[model samples]
Target: MEQRPGKREERKVTESGHRRTAVAESGSPATGARIAGLGAYRPQTVVSNEQAAADAGVAPEWIAQRVGIHERRRATGSETVVGMAVEAAREALDAAGKDANDVDVVILATCSLPTAMPNGAARVAAGLGCRAAAGFDLNAACAGFNHALAVADGLVRSAVARNVLVVGAERMTDWVSAHDRDTGPIFADGAAAALVVPAIRPGIFPVAWGGDGERADLIRIRADTGRMEMAGREVFAWAVTALTPVIRAACERAGFEPGELKGFVPHQANLRIVKALGAAVGAAGSVTATDVTHTGNTCGASVPLALHALRQRGELTAGDPVLLLGFGAGLSYAAQVVLSP
Candidate 1:
């Protein structure tokens, strides 16, 4: 796979004067309970279809024809990363009829942060007024939310936290190059949070995950690492080969077959990836929800954001068995056989 994506590599001057490489591989959890409440917050500044095309050095026709994205949310100069996370968290808590005081733990997942010092999670906690609680981060690229679920699952799984707040938030647009045609229409900014608790009965099932660092160079951003490198063709082939088996294996492990699923919510990275995964698993008629078609890829926030959109559109229903799948940088991927509210 060829590398493409540009990133303003965060640099620093250490006391010893030795430069450091800060690479992260991390963080998700689950409850059998329904979402309780779902909320998300995208930047209010909408980059119009014409505007994004002009900035990315591609025509509006190219963006819409190739990726199906007419517009995407771009963070304002004043919108801090943690600020958006807090806003999204507040929305989710409000919808659930819950408050910051009710939150037990906070997990913030992102590949890009507002600043290197605070890690975003802490500031989010401060904003939400979660006192005396620990806040940390997870960075498994796009698979972050699902991985965060695993961590939150352990919280309730081990009886450590009762109502854990797991957030997948990222400002990917900050990392995108205006001229990179492959990524300009593919990356967006947003955040999504889920309040997790231990599931009831055969509630939250197991998640099947794997990573191939060998392909870590596939989709990345950094110095000397061009903007958004992708073997779009290769990733398409890989998704068909890897995601299908992973989803099916997870289904079997959870004592169900792929055909029985009510919804298949894969990260809305691209239509090519989702449609390929669906065909591989024989999920021809199951509802396949996507917002990346319009929001582009919000990186770590992809899954939860997609689910929120599903619910908003009334596509999600009670007793629905939804399979959540994610694949991204770190060459990481995750799939969960989840039972709905």
Candidate 2:
């Protein structure tokens, strides 16, 4: 994805109408996100793929083979996305040697909020004692985190906020149909939060985006009505066709190539989509890193969950260029190329 002077990168069909390449070093400047702070919270209950399948009348092997999910975490009766997000946000702030009071802005990225009033951001601010801070919600469904990053980037560009906290949390288990097999093994409950602040010039930078709303039904969860509507085959095909361009556009805008990326953090939607995306973008080997197989899909928390897990494995370092991509409901897609702090 070579840059065309002033143009930013985007994901869609390639210039040549075929999948392109995006390669980067793990600690390079092309893609990176400093773990300045991070945290997460899960319900006391744990649900394995087999358990979900059994309860939903689906074969465990079918779920595993199709989605590459082994298990997912579920919240207890008293837990809420707000609580999990607050806990994770506090942990991230603690890791950064700062408290929520130090946070200037809050971006609560979630698909399922505890309530409809006050927005999730306001509640999170109250919990963290950051009452003076301004916060709000920015949703992109499964790509909520990526969308939040774009929003934060714009805010930083305007110097409106210095220390921003982005939390992707969800209690998806509450929405799943206990008798529906399509969603039982896929959706999970979890939260992952991060603190994004100023870094060296090579830090978090330009991101990219892509989408085709006409196919919004590829993956959807109705509100207080029909259960999840997921076209597995449709989603897999769309991912392969749509994701390549998003990465290419983002990398080119950052003045890099698909082969220059060190690591790729795509939304943990399904193992099948992840693998298909990797293959389509020519990253079938080690260039693509993942955690979806074990964690299942945590809705809005998917990317951050992978980040949290990756950092724990000692897989990240300063100056790394990490490419984050996500696609979900709305038939939307977003990819950001941020430099690690």
In angstroms, how far off is 125's CA in candidate 1?
A: 1.1
**Model 2, range 122-203, lDDT digits (tens) per residue?**
8888889874677898778888898888776665444455568899988887777757787777888888888875433435
Go through the candidates in order and give each one's C-alpha lDDT. 0.74, 0.72
The C-alpha TM-scores of every prediction are 0.85, 0.85
List candidate 2 segments past 4 Å from native.
1-35, 223-226, 283-287
**Top candidate (lDDT):** 1
Candidate RMSDs in Å, in order, are 10.9, 11.0
Candidate 2 lowest-lDDT run of ten: 19-28
lDDT of 1 by residue, 129-243 (tens): 9764568888898999888877776676554555678888888878877677777767889898877654444445678999989988777776675356666666666777877
In candidate 1, stretches whose alpha carbon ends up further than 4 angstroms from where it belongs are 1-34, 224-228
Q: What would you estimate as the lDDT of candidate 2?
A: 0.72
